[model samples]
Target: MLPGNVMEIMASPSSLFSAYASFSGSMMLVRTMVNDIIPRPVQAYLWQAIRRLFKANPPVQEHLTLVVEEYFHGQNEIFDAAEIYLRSKIDANTDRLKISKSSDEGVLVSFAKDETILDTFDGVELKWKFVTVTTRRQRRVSYDEGEESQEQYFELSFDKKHKDKIIGSYVPFVIEKSSELKGKEKVLKMFTFGGYGRSWSSVDLQHPSTFDTLAMEPEQKKAVMNDLDRFLGRREFYKRVGRAWKRGYLLHGPPGTGKSSLVAAMANYLKFNVYDLQLSNIRSDSQLRELLLETGNSSILVIEDIDCSIDLPERSAPTQKDPRSELTLSGLLNFIDGLWSSCGDERIIVFTTNHVEKLDPALLRPGRMDMHIHMSYCMYHSFKLLAANYLGIPDTDDENHCHRRVFTEIKGLLAKTQVTPAEVAEELMKSEDPHVALDGLVKLLKQKKRETPADGKLETVEEIEDQLKEKVKIE
Candidate 1:
């Protein structure tokens, strides 16, 4: 062993310890001096200043934030689309998520406020932050201030160089993707006027009706479906012809004839939201216009029992008050086909009435009520459908089935009398067994026939003869 080297190594430990002690003493002295000589606030300010000088600020070229607000006018489609689009980006690594479910819809998962979601598009890294800001407002009604309102937005951060790409390509991509995603898991919403402001409140639409289950005449059902298809595909045609991209339907029929059920079927087939606008709750024409504006695109606005919903006095009648503010037929007609109808696109307005003959000529015109669907009484065909739907009886043209004898008798009764599909459905629903249901329905038909007055008969002798002759011709 080298004596000199050993001594140096032993001395180095003491030197290093002394240096560390000196450094600790110096730090303690500086801290004590700061406490004694400087005010606490001043020391804090100095400390912040030092942090500001050294804290890393992202380069200008690397930072850009695009904000998407929850609403600007009415409800913003972009905000909604973004919300749906973001659902696909959620992953196990996500720190926080919000989960909600409607009574009839699948569980919906979304990113929570202040949660960050990272995504990559075209090799560009994108960061999304859900931000919520709350502000207090004064309750002017009580002359006091204690209410808090919240506004939410999404902050999309990416490199500054990709701004054009994000706007031109990525944003549109999001909208398109959202539409596809929405189509896959459509949860129809039914909105009604309620709550404090008379605004629309929505719940999951659990309607089980569809075209197949609707017991309308085959010809009429086909016509309605065809009309809807034409209307949906003619958006550009409407634009070229300078027409508002909307359609109006007037469903007129007696009670229990499935007017409301048809509306539900249409909504289900189109995958559109249903907005039941109660004109009775509406006070003024302006209010109706505002409510219409609040509705989303691809929605069916139904005003059931329109003939009795409101009193549409003749336009010639003089008004003591300002009629502009009142809910008048003129205002409704204007919103139906006039300039206000152009406010939205891909909309359908349905008006249901028990008396088609009672509606004003202006209200029943071609443009206002484009299609007039007469939901007539149940025919032999509709009875067969009800039998099939309720009793699991297969709808068959073959007359050799065991229930054929009962169906034949029911058909004869239907031909001679008027019975609503709803009534037949109720009778059919009484028994799960097809034979029992058919027999009970036959008894009801006989009772109804025996009670029918001579004047109340559905067909005259001449009409019956004509139908017989037409049937012979077909045969």
Candidate 2:
């Protein structure tokens, strides 16, 4: 029959409904039977083919993903900086936060794992996801030893079209910002070595010494301060000169002449950490190099009593050996002025000695020790400072008769004999009373004067060396 006639016959009310129900049931039965009879592989192939035939094409888009692993090349500096920058951007959008304690910066706040944040820079959209993956490893045992290790990474996605801008401009900007934040938030830490050939230990530095409180001659103090200021401010200048952005200082004086105190003052002035290197503890040149490499930039590397620390041989004496130390004089010189010294920037190396004349002349060369500071005995101006520091004598009160008389007497005694600033400070600290302290200091000065030689002159370097040798022998 013709299609129109057949449809009209079937359109009768009762027949049409029954015919439609029967057709639907028959199709469902056929579908179930076919599905049961077909092998899984054949079904899957058919389904995939159907999907490919009907599926529409996706929109045209390009994406680039950059992954920053937590530990790259065994150092976390770049990763940490990236985390700091990404966390700051993510913090505003993410509700979940992770808080942790840090030894250097105290409390730290970051984004929680699996949190995704959207950010935009330079008209390009970027997405950052804080992801942490836990991996379980099996160990050899009867019982299953599930060792779970966590790995953290930041996945950054941006449009491929803006890849160059993102890599060249945005990333560098983030690093610079991170450095600025670190400079503002992080506290300076002082590191020191303990025991023989052990790793460095650190603590929060809390020294309160400063140039103002330091008892020294006014001119000398000013010069030291100026040199420090210049060194700190000349990062670009050092680079222009093709130098290592480092400065060396040679502080020479007798014992108890405020060398250590001066180092503390320098640390405080620059807000830099002090790495008090004990060369005796270091066993070899390799260990020393490792320590220097590990030290952060903008730190002071101090070697106190360098003369006594090791047998630093003269340049001419290459065969001389120190049985107590394996590190040679050449190795030390290399540590100071060699290729490895360029590993860090904005560094200050200070070598203090009680007997500078006995030191190797190579160490005193111009390039090795840039500034040779002579921390001499207490002078008139230094005594005045010590008095003011201990007894609260105002520098402007020159008109006070008692103060003037005490100052004149102290100056005369200081001229007649040479006593260390430490001795004068110790005497001034004997009493809290201003007059008593000043009078006690004067008495100590007179005692020192009487003990001076018949010529009333300061001890020569030879005499001081002889006394040191005798003292060492007695000890």
Candidate 3:
């Protein structure tokens, strides 16, 4: 019935395929136009009607879900925190670990999809589900040229009865725990300056010192630990009192009396990084402030030998300007207590000196240093602690007569001699044999006593400084 050319064209495979594709495309265009022309309310009603006609209702769940999107108001902190918390739970519960590369840390672990976990807080039950959504979009020019994207999120569900508590208390608690976990997982960093105008260099801090290992009076150690705990716990109190959330410690002691060890111990206890600020290495007041600004929260800033670190001119003394010295006592004081100090929270500043009396009156003032710790000469109790640590002597029992005798002699010698902990520790390390170590310690104590003046007087700061300079010259 048709012409030969028309029959050939209709029978061609390419022409038939093209006609089918054109029909499909025209139908899609018509559907899109209809959707665009329809009012949103009418379209929604039609969609609901269509769904009701063909789709089954989902089963009701007793708990309501709260979805935390990855990006909210251009910040991902909440999403990140939730991911961390959930990942920890998943790691504990599941066998497989999902690993991803991170810019800050080399690698990070997270939960894989289809993993459901249950978490409890303050006797309330909550469930978290890891969901992965994959969406495909076709290009306008070609259907094959399209993009696929995957979005991940966490679905947290809890009973309606716990809605208020979960929002108010549990969320904040999770954030805090997440922060603490992150800190604990990271390596502790220790920073030190090379010289004036030089930047700080960092190393992995591997200090073995702890409150239990440091040789000090038990009561004093307890007091220091308590004070540190109070400081860590009193952020709200500090804010309420209109004070910077920082604490200053003044450690005054003779050389080799465990001041440095105490600083290390504090860092270990608090899990804080230490920035050993060599005051002499700092060139100017502005540099000092910059260094302080560079430091992060939950860190200890230490200035050792504070009395000798700088030539702080007295307020009444004549001003002799030193071109090299730009860091004045006033500037230093301002860095400690001024507006700059309020930049970070949970910070601690420590100053160590051999001579408390030689320190300026302003430095010794009450409000300047919150706590003044006097690291005294090795006492009997401290010696006992050292013995336990070095020789494995148990403080619990005095059953062994040899150990008892050694303890008694050491106690007597310690009362008479002002032996340093460093000296005692060194003597203890000389021999693995407990008896030999104790005997060597006693001999060293006797030798020190014999060398001392009749009044058993200790060298003053000025005398010590002179001896140090002489020693340096000899070296």
Candidate 4:
């Protein structure tokens, strides 16, 4: 049945291809391939082979293939060295350094089993030793797969000792990434120390698809990608730019704007873990410090809904504790770059809030929150993302009369409507099929537009900034 479908597609003229000519596309009977209809194990091998031929990045395979080959050679060399080391141990009679005890509570040693031979100190053979010693073999239990298995070896022991020898012990510790290990490589290790953070667990992030499930407009998507490239940074080049080994990013916009999902994608792109810091969990500065210290290096520490976590000290109600001061601001500052802020191994700290301007100025300073990313509403391009994500159309960058009309309405609606990607996604999910829902959004917008009055003018930023200065005076 699958072969027949492929045969039909191949046999059919790119005949039904006119609509796609304008870079327009269609929802298809086959989102994937005929072989994809087969069992996964067989498909896995075929997909593996396909990746060799056509990877997302062609250079990756070429370099990766060479790297694997090099690793194989290096492993062989290590095995050969091990073989030589084993032969040397069997062939050489390495001098044994042995210790023995004496009657005076001082230790005695011997070139021979008899202590008189090598016990001489300061050119005098001391016969003051009043104790005798005996040596015996120490055996440990061993497991054998079969009766024919080779014999077990024994360690030397004193005749009187009954139990096995205690092995030397040392404190168990986790080594933080060292500067030497990072070297000139652009990748720096992210380390958090002396902070209130999870010592054993850091938040995990899902990978980002190269493409958003929702289609984006070509120009808008390009702009977003370019902006993100500069802000989120490239894997290989960020450190050379004199930026901090760690960066603080602010993601702010209306609710349900896909900020959380974008974070997941960013982590997937960077292969970073997420350390989701909760302000409520941090009642004291020290607890915050500890939590920060415990997070894994190469992580994205996120404080979602940051604006609501604590009102700006000024806006906060009067209390015994000064709400005007972030009870933990000093601690947060230390984690940022204060003298106490040890540059952690390369990490990105993300703070998401609907209200960014309300944040404390010191907290938002250049070095503190290095990047401010506005995850704005679903623009025309962003609509494409939604369409693609829900509709699975690969978005041939199409702009038909219906598509154009609907997207234009969405853009206008977005200008006034505080709809979130999550909200739109919810709508898409409510219907059994997305293509039909995409059409429904157009009708919904028209009805909403008529019901709502035209967007009345609002105060401009300069006006609001001036008004805020007068209306909301700070002490």
Highest-TM-score candidate: 1
lDDT of 4: 0.49
What C-alpha RMSD separates each model from the true structure?
Answer: 8.1, 10.1, 13.5, 35.8
| Worst lDDT 10-window in candidate 4 | 62-71
Q: Please write out the lDDT profile of model 4 over residues 41-150, one tens digit for every residue.
A: 87788889988788676452111100011013111222222222222222123244244553323443222222111122233221211122332323235543322211
- Candidate 1: how many backbone clashes? 0
Return model 4's CA RMSD, one decimal.
Answer: 35.8
Over 125-194, each residue of candidate 3 has an lDDT whose tens digit, in order, gives: 8988778776666657775946654556678899877899999998898888788876657546688765
Q: Lowest-lDDT window of 10 residues in candidate 3?
A: 466-475
TM-score per model over all chains = 0.73, 0.62, 0.59, 0.48
In candidate 3, which residue pairs clash? Answer: none
> Candidate 2 at 230: error in angstroms?
2.6
Off by over 4 Å in 4: 1-211, 214-244, 311-326, 394-418, 432-435, 450-475
Instruction: List the candidate 1 regions with Cα displacement exceeding 4 Å.
Output: 1-74, 93-170, 452-475
On TM-score, the stronger of 2 and 4 is 2
